[model samples]
Target: MSSRSYDIAVIGAGVIGAAIAAQLSRYAVRVVWFEAAHDVAEGASKANSAIACTGFDMAPGSLESDLILQTNPQWENICRALDVPLRRIGALSLAFDDGDSDSLRNLLNQAREAGIEAELIAGDALRREARTAAPSAIEALHVPREGIIDPIRLTVGLAKLAVLNGVELRCSTPVTGFRHHPSGAISHVVTPTGATAVGAVVNAAGVNADLITDAAVAEPFTMWPRKGQFLLLDRAVGHLVPKIMCTAPTPHTRGIYAVPTTNRTVLVGPTAVDGDDRGDKTTDGDTLDAVWARAERLLPEGVERRHVTKTFSGLRPASDRTYRIEVSAKVPNLVHAAGIRSTGVSAAPGVASYVADLIGAEVMELPVKSSVRESIPVIPRLAEIDTDVAATAFTARPGAAPDEHPIVVCACEHVTAAEIAAECRGPVPATSLDGVRKRTRATAGRCQGAYCSVGVSFILSAATGDQPGEVRHGEPGSHWETPVR
Candidate 1:
């Protein structure tokens, strides 16, 4: 078996792991990233609320709150540097009755305590300003800094940035075991591919992080999958929900929310159901129906079931504790960045920086690079081509074949042939149809690949040199059977 060595190993290629690896790449350290999935963000990062939270209502002094607050102000620059799409369109928390209004007031107080800007607006004023809001909402809590982002794009961008900066990313490589030194430091990480000798390790494996931790030492906490089912409406309904509309927070969850995606589509639902099965991402009709009912109470009249394009579920790493960002006392070289729940997308930047500090001080010395690439070139998509400059700004990568005729592949989202091929041939190339979809939005539109899957399959077949039937839709062993026609 082949073997390799690295100074540091970051497990899990979800948002948190990607962020941590990206941040670490700026230093003079040899880093290796491992993901069991076929591509990055294949786990919880694949599906989410897509909201860039402001931490305005987070509990005061909590690690989640502090990290969110610390990172919230950096998103504008962060998104710009990473070339991820972000919309600072703000969010509203609607209150249906007196109890909810009081909750809004309490949230406002919490925001004030956290030094976040927030205001409670009367329902009449909210309805006047945000025409899409329901009239039954007695009051609304407005947090102007709350926004929407492309969560998949964000995770991919981070992973790509790390790859560009000399971090070796090993996709489909899950760390199965760890070999420790006599001093109790992790000396090697064992994966199916091979074993890699490492100086330190970071466990950011989402719901499976506890398992990694327990492998080295008895973990103080355990993790379960908190399943959240969501519904994606077509871009036709995007105009109906201009901003994020949220219900009052219950003790267990933030409740169902309706948020606009950067792709100009509206996302609703996310029924937070806790369970022990981390692999059970299946969606039920009854659960989704109840979530849709809650969404209907917040959105405008134009939203209908006909506009629904996709239904998906994600498993967040739910634990008994809050955010766990610490170096393990049992294994001095092991760092824990797990149990980060729903707000992981928003908390990534802060968590990354915090974990980097721990790794530097406790694990090893991370010398800052004299020079680092702060930003990557932005590749404009067909959907984002509005200005004259953007239309004329298309440039093929160094080794990519020039697209003499840019044929439209996904008509629902305006994804072009060149875009699909580019993602498939990217530095972090798309090995599966879902990978291409996350990068280029090729088959994630209104038709949900009904009209575009065949085209996309052909593109993947050509890019990877796979046969028509060998082109996989998503992970390994998910190949599509070509028609007999």
Candidate 2:
């Protein structure tokens, strides 16, 4: 019904887009970030292995290697500013056979060229280093800079910081197309609501980038979906792997891996299933079985399906030319940051910095604002705090009314009514049951919303002023009544 204008417009609110938007906020400029999903990181950023590894084993001269190598070192400062959780536990690419050992040597050689510290550990040292690593693994390439992170927290934190820096985030605003000027520069962007006039445009649309580029008359940069099926084991299984354990990469795939997530859950995953649809997040039985079969080979104790709490999948924006981040040749003021595969989480900040520099040169150069806030407020999780402290803090809030029965909505995850209410009405409100689950952890426990879903739906209804039955489960066109099959 109404249209707005901006100095710049960024399409896609995944890690890449969020990082770009956040970085651009450092300067005094009008920027708008657009996301098609109900929430940020709803795609590959939410899934993936969630590992922030140095691009040690990447192709030495490739774009991905360059971006990751440059970006990996900045994570500490970035995470600190955003208040996101990060753990630098390191990783070991296990060599199961003599041939795999040869591959480890090659991977280490590449690491050396990339200036990353990757050591070859074998025999007694290898066995003692990873207690859970199988004895059959004769050697491993020890990558010291590899780390694990909470992907959801990282994406949300970046978006929040961007919002704080005066970057307007418009979630659920899908960019329909682009209009170009006579001189070949991007004139503005067309969204579902209305067109937004802009000086420049950045296409970080993940798998859907080709649609935007095609309309802009750029070279055909087609992207296909490369699905990675993964499993999340219970916290009890976290002790099974002391560090991020992985297998030597094959020619076609990155192989499978297991990690102890920062959240204290054992994450086993990433079967490199290629050529699936972007919307195909379906966890296939065959792929999952394959994933565990490979993952168990690297672990002392084999993993059983019984210990698995969640089975899910994420799609990477696979392309013939991966990590093709550059300014569009055909369309002026059009920057393209797409096809950042598995290492998106690690490479996001780097992408953002690069895109920001491009925008500063091409679009509008604005001075840094002195009043730009450094950090956004972080909410405390009740699950991590001491019970006594949480209880005392919960009741300490200044209020005249007192209730005899303090409502506890999610017993499995220990989520309470007050926490749900706060997030439902927070700066970036939860639009669906899954949105609330990601924000508050309600109905995301062992039972997987078996008991708390109805209550969460009721709370959503109250917060959004909708009828209880009208509460949706996830994204648009989805409802809570039907279970995921």
Measured by lDDT, the strongest candidate is 1
Q: Pick the candidate with the highest TM-score.
A: 1
Clashes of 1: 0
Colliding pairs, model 2: none
lDDT of 1 by residue, 1-485 (tens): 34667899999999999999999999998899999998999999988888889898788899999999999999999999988988889888888989888889889999999998888888467876568656577788888889899999999999888998989999989889988888988998999977789999999999999899988773567999989999998888788787788899867668788888998888898888889887899999999899998888887876788889889999988898869899997889999999999999999999999999998888899999988888766765878887576456554446654331356789988888787887887768898888889998988887788888888888888889998678988888998776777
Residues 1-485 of candidate 2 have per-residue lDDT tens digits of 23667887888988888888888888877888889988888888888888898988788888677778888888887788776878888899998888888888989999999889989998888877788566688899988779998787788788888887888889888888777788988787888887788888889999888887987778787888888888888776677787898889878767788888887777888876677477988887887887888778876665567889999888988887877788888786888998888888888988888888776776567678778877877665666569898887666345622211236788877787766776677666787898888777788777899999888887788788877677878887787673546
Q: Rate the local accuracy (lDDT) of all candidates.
A: 0.87, 0.81
On the 0 to 100 scale, the lDDT of residue 47 in model 2 is 82
Off by over 4 Å in 2: 1-3, 386-392, 395-408, 482-485
Error of 1 at 255 (Å): 1.6
Global Cα lDDT for candidate 1 = 0.87
- Estimate the TM-score of every prediction: 0.96, 0.93
